[model samples]
Target chain A: MTQTKIDGRAKTREIKRKANLNLLERLYLPEIFKGLSITFRQIFKPKFTFEYPDVKWQPPASFRGRPVLVVDDETGVERCVACGLCARVCPALAIEVVADETELDKERYPKKFEINMLRCIYCGLCEEVCPEEAIVMSKEYELVFTSREEAIFGKDKLLTPASKLKDRLEFLRKMR
Target chain B: MESILIAILKAIIFILLFLTFSAVLTYVERRISAFIQDRLGPNRVGPFGLFQPIADVVKIIFKEEIIPANADRTLHTLAPIISLFVAYSVFAVLPIGEKLVIDGKEIKLVLADVNVGFLYILALSSLGVYGVTLSGWSSNNKYSLLGALRASAQMISYELSLGLSLVGVVLVSGSIQIDEIIRSQANVWNIFYQPVGFIIFLVSVFAETNRLPFDLPEAEPELVAGYHTEYSGMKFGAFYLAEYTNIITASLLVTAFFLGGWYFPFVDIYSGLNPNLSAILQVIVFFGKASLIIFLFMLVRWTLPRFRYDQLMRLGWQVLLPLALLNVLVTGLVKILL
Candidate 1:
């Protein structure tokens, strides 16, 4: 037969230990002085408060902002080349593209492209899957709009100047 | 008519002083608590946060007031006013310094030198419970009601011990007048004579003011916001102001009764000094005693863990009450024997 276990003694010992701890806390004289000393020290210390609006906190270095499709400034044409990679990789199914034949290059180009930013997860997956290096994530955090329809960016809102990145970096540095 | 006018002027000055002290106490409480915790407190508002209380006042005044629809409007409004008024009223008889003569006439620092000043303070302190109770009841919230009940019960229970503890002092002084008691304590001080009574009184005062280690009613983790749960803006500020004023008043009463008010030890050695200089020295001594008591009160507030509701009640009824009675009985017996 297996040896019978006796848990009662172990439990009793644990209870006894807890009881002693309680008694020690109650009887300790230095503990009282230590507690009082904390309040006394805090009395003359400066309060931590920041006046908002006039003094805004700079966002963390790695903070991700709104995603945007990049355009080549010299070419001044559609850089997407109807790759369909962004639409496939999008987790929220927010990006859509319609392919059509272009007159200049005779290559399939996007006739209708739309990104429902309200549904966009901003995970940078769209930028990751781009083969032509057309789309890149932007650092525009202040993305407020009056209406939901206005928030859904089409080809028009996605087409931002390439030099906008240099200006954004400087602005972020100045905020720091 | 002239006497009445002078009395009004004195009262106004006293109220202003009390208000100023109460406000400064807020700053002191935060700074002292911070220092004990090994951190710097509010020092940015003004030099060493001297104007922090004023800034707090402005913020509270400007904050949008929110009144709950279910709350009893009249009682909710009246509660804080009652608390502040009672707290302020206790200082009317509190002597900050002895009388002085500018040209010929003697002017007392105190607003009133009433014979029943001790009783007046006791009565007003008891009255402070009404504000907590009413605020809790009027809020139509369960937590508020519970907090109110705890506060009222704690105050009422401790008050018996508090009043009894002081009986030893009153008996020895043979007068209910605070001024008379202080004058009697000039030579020896009541602390030496009635040590047990003084301890009981100090404990009971902590309970009476609903301060830390005795602050069951406003236990933040358990009760959320406690008695003034629904109060907002200036209303909440009133309760805060009342609390600090009550603390200052408790300090003043302790100094006057136990530490020998306005009396410096071995001052007779300076007999050759001018009478005016002596009076100034006495005033300094009185304020010094008061400051020590205030600092001790703040220290104790941070040191002890708040008693559980049952423990608080047990201490008040079983421990302190019995001890106060015994102190009084022993004092009475000693007086008779001597």
Candidate 2:
């Protein structure tokens, strides 16, 4: 700490005063005119603007949007075994899952799973806590709902086929 | 009887043209500002939102006229009227063309041929301060009063420089009439000789008209819509319209004073055209010159940041006033020497 303070003091000593403006420059009027000239040129420069609504922005696969339940392709069933892990992990209390008995391979399946889009913080915590990789973040970000009822995304809204979520699954696999 | 008809025609033409121009400017200002910020502005109203101003007018007309319970209703109503009146009235003295000949009677392009037109313009613009001050005072809000004070202060400070700057033009041209000033510039434009005067006059008009870089009166962040805070509906629209109309008038004045109104260089070659055609061409040239200056006004608004209230005051009193006085002195000395 003592050596660092000495070095800092020596460095401060090397600092030089900035050059002052000449009398003409000090007048400020000419420099303002120069600044105006620059901005005038900017008006003709190529603008980077989108015709939004007509042309949508396509976010990358790595983009974390609304969390969705992954539907297994071969089995034709939601991979969420109604483990209730997502509900427990949701910081916003946005997720609600009710487990029911299933005859096929898994003993438990979610009879009712709901995620309140309004309450959802888009933290991806629910997606991360999924034990079976059942839920993952999907890039379908542009959400519009006038009513609260419409905003509460149920299984109909939440479920995405594993084929559609290949990129996110692969990314997760790579990370793991 | 024919001259009366001609005067009426001029009035109708002037009113219709300015209103349309002011309306078009609303759309243009939005589009230009949007481009500056790299965003696509209102393109949904009509094709490229060309009809946006019409929609805006409709909306403003339909909006409820709200008067604050504790506010001065009479003064509040009167303020916008006064502002609109002053704005429309100033165009009376401005000459846009040479003359129009129809049925053997030639009509002067200007609505009124007042001898002291320039002085009238200066006087009327000074009175415009009342409208802003009344609007602020009547609003019964602290912010409104503050905005009113700032606006009145700004107008008063700049009015001196605005009047002083034009004195050099008056001295050189040897006439206070707007028409005579333009007529005198036929040989050589006043801008060549009075460049400093033109600069001072130009900057002063920006402040006088309450344009950006000098728009502390309605500084969005500080004062919520300035003196017109409590105004609603058409009253608010009137003040907004008045501001834009003032811009056109200022541009016209600039064209008249320095740019040689309706007098383009080497125009004698084209003087052989049909007399009516020549007059029409001169009118076109005048408007063309005015439009260029108006474009500069809008460009400067987007380019420069607003001056601080103190800096604005300092500029009016310190820089522009001294420069304008010097220009007048030089012009006076040159007149005597020559």
Candidate 3:
């Protein structure tokens, strides 16, 4: 064994070929006592358990949850321009969009937009491909459906308020 | 006739107490193990999960009982019954405290107080092996058979040391009767006289109870629940109850023999108190000591990993047996010399 000084601290670099057991170690009882003491002390330490259902986990900004259409808070209209890039980029083919002329400055808007949550892989590819930053991943991960019809999320279900998705939008802006 | 009636009443009360204690022990074991691992155990069912065992019993009772095809039906049913029976019956001879006098009639804390109490305990505990063995054989499953084989072999190997270790206690106390042994320890506890024997006894008891570090019979990784693999519903619950009961019995025996049963050390505070009150205090003190040993049992279970079968065998026959015998020899020599 050799000792080397790194950052003013001695670090042993050598590895022993075999462990040399002393008389006390070979006897086994002393080692057993050491292990017992460790567990005994741990009984007083704080628990790491999260009582699920009663207490829920809040994921961080980087978390990629369900995809949603961002609804503008000021105008009360969806930010989607109906470019069909999200529909094309979806690997699961979960998204669908129908374009129509609108009175808004964007000119084109989705007449009918839907995302089949059942088929969604949650890959965030749609969120990445969208040029308008209209579709982004929201923090709402709890998706439950009773039937196939219910699983196909329509405009009402997919459109989330922009203010509610600020954390994910900010994270995406910084990362992108 | 009156003595027989008193014995029956005592037996009923003890049985109820043991059953309740074992149920509470399951909860305590889970809570303690969780604390050791930095997790909260089952605290959802009730406050601190005290009612978890009751929920478990209800679930087990409602579950569908499944006996494998081509398995011997009689022995399959009989195995768990035997296990539970032996676990409960061993306590019959265990002296908990000194005599209680009520209405000018004396009552012994122990149910039987048999003269051969020591031999009786040894005999009944060995009989507990039959339950494990029969369950494995009757299951007709390879894993169950392997578990039963391991259990019987381990129990038989450790029983030698377990019996021999107590011989030192018998020698120091000069009697095989358990109450006699307790009476002898009134001056000084047997652990001070036979520390080697105590260690050997403690180790052997761990093996005998099929606890962790020696639990080859139910080694989950290898044997897949061992002898109870094919058992389900209340039948499996029977085996579970029996295991916890064995732990309590082991703790009680350790307290009675080595830690000085029901006697407060170096003092006789009971001399000035009422006889009935003193007897109740003695019973409380005995159980308090036993619960400490029980805590040690739970601690050891969570501390050490299971020993390999070969290592377990070597530790039993090669190490503990020789040590127990030497302990007896030295204890006898000292008795004659002094």
Candidate 4:
């Protein structure tokens, strides 16, 4: 950015005074009529109304909705090693994880995981910070929670089968 | 007794029709404004949102009425009623059709048929300022007071041009009665002779009605709800109703003065039909002309930004008032020459 020698108020005032008009502009009616004519023409223009309830908008996988935990199709278990990276990176302090030992190749699994939907800004930082690509933004934008307890999403709500998360996974891979 | 019966019947029928038309206008305005902005307006209320106004009436009626503790109770209660009364009262003298024949008796379509109908309308419209001003003063709020002042000042400033513009029509027609004015234009509309005056009158009517581009009193950015800031529930509804009613009254006045009220072009060709049928057709024609003017009002509202306070003042005093006087002078000269 180029630094100015002085404050720009004087320059703006100069530009304002410089934009002079002739006799016709002084009349004002012609310009008013021109504006009216343009708006009159717009009466026949096509309207862009999305009847939202009847017609649901299916955004592409790259479109971030809400973050979800990815489950491995082969092993029928979560791909997450319960790493605290997401919890640490979440700006809103929305994510919580309790790690426990597991028998699987991934030695650690989250015994409990909760995200306070109220606190979550949906910034996708937690998803970005995940090392294993276990948490990714999903296509579940419509979220309505009546109570505080209902808003705190747990593992049962977060863990989606890998098959359902195919589009988002492919999208992330393409981006990388 | 017979005349009184006719009067009561006419009043009942016209009031219902007028209120219904105002409600429908709200729906039309929303739909048209939405189309202009490339968005769908309210369509979910009912079939094409036709029943939306009914729903609105219900909502407004049920809303709790709130009065500011410091507000003048008597003036606050009386203000909106005065506005509504004035708005509806102006329609009393406007001639909508020729004489109606029933049971071998003739009945004039207008309610009062005041000898100086045009002057009466102008007088009543000026009185409309009191309603707004009172609402503002009684509310005891700063914004409301400013709005009230703006409204009164703007109305007074534009009323001069408004009156001057109509003088062209009055001079050309050589009559003050609205019926006689329309009758005078059986051959040609006054708009042809007084084009400049017609334009001035149209602009002044926008200002008079507190419509957009001249809606300084209720400028949302500057004043929150303006004079009606403290008004709630049915009282607020009355103000809203008064506003829409004023719009219709202004359109009707424009029709009566410049557009030749019920006098359609080539009306002699259709003269062979039944007189009753012809009268109905004439009323329909008058309504058609008025609707076009009303649509223009809506189109303008969506098109133009609100004028700055000083700009509004300048346009009213400097531009329109002088132009109206010039038009009157030219019209007078032409009348004498012809």
Candidate that would win on TM-score: 3
Sort all candidates by DockQ, best to worst: 3, 4, 2, 1
- What lDDT does candidate 3 reach at residue B61? 98
TM-score per candidate for chain A alone: 0.62, 0.82, 0.87, 0.81
RMSD of 2: 3.3
Q: Please list all clashing residue pairs in model 4, or write none if there are none.
A: none
lDDT of 2 by residue, B164-273 (tens): 88999999999998888988999899999799889898998999888888988898898988888888899999999999999999998999999998887656534667
Model 2, residue A121: distance off in Å is 1.7
Predicted structure with the largest lDDT when compared to the true one:
3
Against the native complex, each candidate's DockQ, computed on alpha carbons, is: 0.29, 0.48, 0.78, 0.71
TM-score, candidate 2, is 0.93
Candidate 3 per-residue lDDT, tens place, B131-243, comes to 99999999999999999999999999999999999999999999999999998988899999999999999999999899998899899999889999999999999999999
Which digits, one per residue and each the tens of the lDDT, describe model 4 over residues B242-329?
A: 9998998899889988887887776564367777888898888888889999999987898789998898898989999989999989
Candidate 3 TM-score to native:
0.95
- What DockQ does candidate 2 score? 0.48
| Candidate number with the higher TM-score (2 or 4) | 4
lDDT per residue, candidate 1, A1-176, as tens digits? 23445686643322224445566576454577776676566665665545444556555434456766666677777577887999999999999988888776627778878888789888878776777656766766777888989978888888776665544434444654
Fnat values, candidates in order: 0.60, 0.40, 0.97, 0.80
Candidate 3: misplaced stretches above 4 Å? A1-19
Q: DockQ of candidate 1?
A: 0.29
Residue lDDT tens for model 4, A1-176: 33335475543232235367888987777888788788888878887777998988999988888889999998889888998999999999999999999888889999999989999898988888799999988999999999999999999999998999999999888887
Error of 1 at B195 (Å): 4.1
Q: What is the lDDT for A18 in model 2?
A: 50
List the lowest-lDDT window of 10 residues for candidate 4 chain A. Answer: A9-18
Q: Candidate 2 overall Cα lDDT vs. reference? A: 0.88
Q: Which ten residues in a row have the lowest lDDT in candidate 2 chain B?
A: B266-275
